[model samples]
Target: MLLNLAIKNFAIVSFVEIDWQQGMTTITGETGAGKSIAIDALSLCLGSRALANTVRPGCAKAELTATFDSSNISKATKWLAKHDLQQDDECIIRRIISIEGRSKAYINGSPVPLAQLKELGQLLINIHGQHDHQLLMKSQEQRRLLDEYADHQELLSSLKFYQSKWRKLNNELTLLQQNSQQRQAQLQLLQYQVKELDQFALQDNEFTQLETDYKRNSNAQQLLLLSQQCIEQLSESNNITEQSSALTQLQKSSEQLSQLAELDSAAAAIASLVNEARIQLEEASKDLNDYQQSIDIDPQKFALIEERYSFAIQLARKHKVAPEELVSFHSNIKKQLNAIANDDSRLDVINDELEQCFSQYLEIANSLHKSRTTAAQQLEQQITNSMRQLNMPDAVFKLAITEKQLNEPANHGIDEIEFLVSMNPGQPVEALAKVASGGELSRISLAIQVILAERIVTPTLIFDEVDVGISGPTAAKVGQQLHKLGHSTQVICVTHLPQVASKGHQQLFVAKLTDGKHTQTKVTELNQPGREREIARLLAGDEVTDSSLANARELLAS
Candidate 1:
């Protein structure tokens, strides 16, 4: 239950704190005395959008806070626990809006987003009023309320899981059907690439060897000719034996120098030079003979090297890669070919998987549809009994379920269910919101809310002059219904009828007070005696005559 509400800088309610009780509480005041300010503040605390103008004049910001006792709100407690914002026994929700258009929301002292506040707010309060868009009037809202009462969330969850799976499979099938030609074109390209790679017939290290051999053999003739000249100069001459002739001349010079060595030291030095020159010439002749034997320029082998070099370049250009990538190209093409060849088998497996998913989804959806059909009948009977007690005895009510065609996954079923009604006995049944008179609708809504309070988690309900067009027995019935509903939930109502106010467990009176140029709105909680006096004033205006006071006291006693 909502225990307290505090408002600061909110319209004419500069600062106000209201402590409330669990059962019915009614607020009464003269017109335009700022009674609606309390409702507006409650709305903001429950996550309604706020305007900068809602702040009192001369104030930069407005603040509203509501404290709720969540001992009985299990789901709300769990939600708060998950978010680390649980306040052991009570939850405080606060909203602050600045004149510069900045807004902030908080739950249990933890900052939260406005959207989160809005989502959690519905769990604590519901307000029903005249000239108000009540939730029961809308088909979707009606369905949700019934689902909440019946605890059909698990069934709805299953249905949603199915819908998501069905959509995914449907999307995949469409994509594959539309892109089959594209896949075929890709397969053809892959096949052609594989054939091109096979024809190249590349070998590892073949290009390196071919180029090396070409470079060596390109200068083979020049090397051979150079070696022949060296051989002649050293040891291979036919007419002139070059190395042998040089050796013989050196020996002759050495022998003559040796004969003169005993007579002169300079002749001995000349003999040593001739011996060294003959030894170096002999080694040079041997090296030249080795070079002539090793050079080979075979025409067939040279032709093969040239052709292989040209082929390496051609392969590189055709495949658009360096010579080293020839081996890699072969591996890539083979992999693509394997994928294309096995594609049909893989596609069959995918199709089978999607079929299984689709079947699972349909099965879940059908189960949920059946549960809703059964629950609707039970819910119709319950609401009918409630409305009869709210002074609409002759009214006829029906739960009309029509198959919805929008293809959405509804928790109830693949159908739209409306709360249809006929206010008069002879009239044909029509939509409840359209056919019921204002007063009848008020009573009916109260009855439905009373039934919902047990199932819904919200702790507070606000009725804004819902008994506006009612009086006498009808007004008394509205009071009785509120009294009954209040036993289980806290109800805040703005009312003009003493019949309703007298039945409330608590009463607050809104009045205008003037000080100099300032006009302020004040709300005060009244004790039993004060409440009777206030009701007397409501009945007989400012006079509060003897009969009116006596009647007000009688109402309190009753």
Candidate 2:
């Protein structure tokens, strides 16, 4: 339920604070006295669109704040908790509109998007404007009202979920069908590429090993000549040269030092060093001879290695990669080929899944259709009964449920609902917009609201002059229904009828005050005498007479 409303610098309302209560509160004023200004301010707090003109002429901005007690409203409390904006059981919604046509919204002191404010606002209050009945003309709004009256949120949610899933799967199937030829062409190209790489037969680390073998074999004769020359120089040789071989010279030097060692210790050390050098030369010569024997000069093996190395280079350049990268590149192409081969199977699987999703969607849609059909019948009867109580004895209300073609699925299911009415005894029932007059529309709108009020969970309901085209006993019936609604929830009504104003448990009078240069609107909560005078004024216009006061008292007493 709404606890309070604070508005400042909004339109001609410089400042107004209203402490609302848990029953019907009527607002009354003279014509052009800004009686609806408070409702307008409350609308801003409910996230309605704001304009720069909403700000007072001399003020920089307009501010509105509304406080609600949501301790018993689970939907509102859950929404606050879900958004992490909960402040115990009190929900404060504030809106600020700047003169530049910009606006900001806050919930529980945390800044939020305007959409969040609107979403949370719906759970807290339902406002029925004087012209809300005009919305009954639209088919979509008709469907929504019927669905809301049906109270089958679970079924609606299921239908929407399956519809979403079906749409996604259907889109995938469409794309796959459109791209079938392109996928086939891609698959062929991948197949040929994979075949070429497979024939190359490159192995990991084989490229480097092949290069080493080729280099060693290509220089076989040169290696043999160099090895033989080194061996001949290190040992004794028959070559006719003036220089003795290194091994022969070292042996001769060792013999001369050994003879001198008997007379000198230093000569003995030198002889020992010469002998070690001779031994090292002999070992080096033996190893060189062994290497020379191991060298092969086979042309067949050399030609094979050269051919393999050239082919590796050519294949690497063809693939736009180094020879060492060929193995990894071959592996990647194989994987792509395998994936392309699987697309046809994937298409079949998607088609099967799409069918399953559509089946599920149809199941839920059929259930929802049945529920709506039943609800339409029940609501038609209830609203028809309510119309009689609102003084429309001959008015007939009907809900037309037309089923669309099954192939054309909609988020709201297959039923197209519309409200039809007959206002006279001999008149055929026709669309509400085409048949009902403005006064009839007001009563119809009120009847629907009063009937739906029992099922709607919103804590507060505000009627903005909904009794505009109603009067007499019909106006009293409207007032009585509103008062009855207030028994279950909070109701604030802006009205111009004495019958309605006299029924309010509390009353507020909106008065315009001016000093010739400036005008402002003030809302004052009325006590017993004040209410009597206001209701008397509503009954008798600007002049309050004894007869009007007596009528006002009798109306209040009743």
Candidate 3:
């Protein structure tokens, strides 16, 4: 339910804030007193397209803010989560329009695209406007309305699944049939590619190991020379490397150590280290020889390696991939080979699946059709009954459903449905939104929303001037229905009738005045006597009489 609305710098209105009612709220003013300016503010929050002209003259921007009471926001919360939008217990939707015609929408402090705002707004509130009447003239919209009343979403899902399967099968069959008389060369190439890939027998992560081995073997000679050179320098017999280095130096020092035994006992340990260094040099030399001998540098082996590398490179180039992608390339070729070789069998399998899907779809669709027909009939009967309550005693509503060739998902089936109405007996029923008067259409729209609100989980409904043309007892019935609708879903109706206004659990009055140079709009709640006076004003004209006050008081007290 809309809790409050605030507008600033809108056309003919400088600023206005309205605390709305949960049930049958009414906005009453003399016809041109800017009732529409208030509606325009709500429209902005509803994501209606804005124009620079709507901005007040000399104002840089126009702004609108709406707060919704959200004690039960499960549906809205789930949708917010789905769209990655912020979720809160309250709905604070705001819109800003610049004088240059740019607009922005925000929800719970998060910026949102106008389209998202519009989509989410529909779930929160539905505005019945002149264009909504045009929806009746369109056969497609009529079908959708009936389907919505039927609540047949699951059946539609099954039907769509079947249609998808049929299309897939048809596409496969057509492709194979078109290529059947030829394609032998393509098939042979695929098979050959698959066979070659199998011969290589590629394994995951093996490429890294092969590259490492290749690099090690390619530098084996250099590495062996370096290692052997180190060993030779360590083992040189005549230079410092022999006499001053390692073993030769140690031998000279050990002979001197015995002459100076008291001061040179530590020389033995140094000599031992030199001996170990000589052993290390010997082992290093042997290891180097082993490594050098192990490297396979035969011309035949080199040629084989070169041939394998060239093949890998050429294949990689053909596929526009690196040699390391060989595994993926092999898998792709294998898949293509399977598709080609098993084309006939796969086609048969798909055809069987298509037939099965079609049979299942038809069976369930027929059941769904029967259920929808029953539901539509019941819905039509209920709306027809509601018309009598709204003071149209001889009215009837009809649900018209026809078989249609479908290409996509529908809430129901491949059947087009329409809502037709006749205000009098023995008259042809026309589309509801078309033939009904402004007031009658409002009632019809209200009835449908109220009835469906019991089924659909939408949390809020807004009726914009649905009480425009109705008065007397019929207006009272309409207000009662709205009251009932509000019990289940949050409802806010902009009404002008005292019967309707009096039914509100709350009431707000929209008043406009020009303070010399600028026009301003202000909205405020009416206390008991004040509400009665407002309703009296609606009951009578510009003048409020005692009799009108009595009538207003009676309506409110009742």
lDDT score of residue 74 within candidate 2: 97
lDDT of each: 0.79, 0.88, 0.74
- Per-residue lDDT, model 1, residue 19, is 95
TM-score of each candidate structure, all chains considered together = 0.71, 0.79, 0.70
Cand. 3 Cα-lDDT: 0.74
Off by over 4 Å in 2: 30-33, 100-103, 201-339, 516-518
Q: Please tell me which model should have the higher lDDT, number 1 or number 2.
A: 2
For model 3, residues 1-558, the per-residue Cα lDDT tens digits are 677888888887777777765555655666667766766778787799996577889899998998876557666667777877655677788899999999889988789899878877877776665245445657776666766877777877777777776777778778987887565678888877788778877677656666665666567678777756665554444454333444445456556654565577766676666556656756765776676567665666655655666677677787688889888888887887777778857766876776676677677778777877899888889888887888889989998877766543344456767788999889999876667887787667667766777777666566667665677888899888877777776666677777877887777777877768776777777789999899898888879999999998999888
Candidate 1 residue-pair clash tally: 0
Model 1: lDDT of residue 105 = 92
The reply for model 3, stretches above 4 Å from the true place, is: 6-15, 36-69, 72-126, 156-186, 196-276, 288-332, 335-346, 404-411, 428-443, 446-460, 468-491, 496-506, 527-558
Q: Which scores greater on TM-score, model 2 or model 3?
A: 2
Ranking by lDDT: 2, 1, 3
Could you tell me which 10 consecutive residues in candidate 1 have the lowest summed lDDT?
Answer: 404-413
Where in model 1 is the C-alpha error above 4 Å? 129-137, 181-187, 190-362, 402-412, 426-428, 512-520, 540-544
27-130 in candidate 1: lDDT tens per residue?
A: 99888998778888989877787876788888899999999998898877888888888988899999999988788999999899988787777777888766
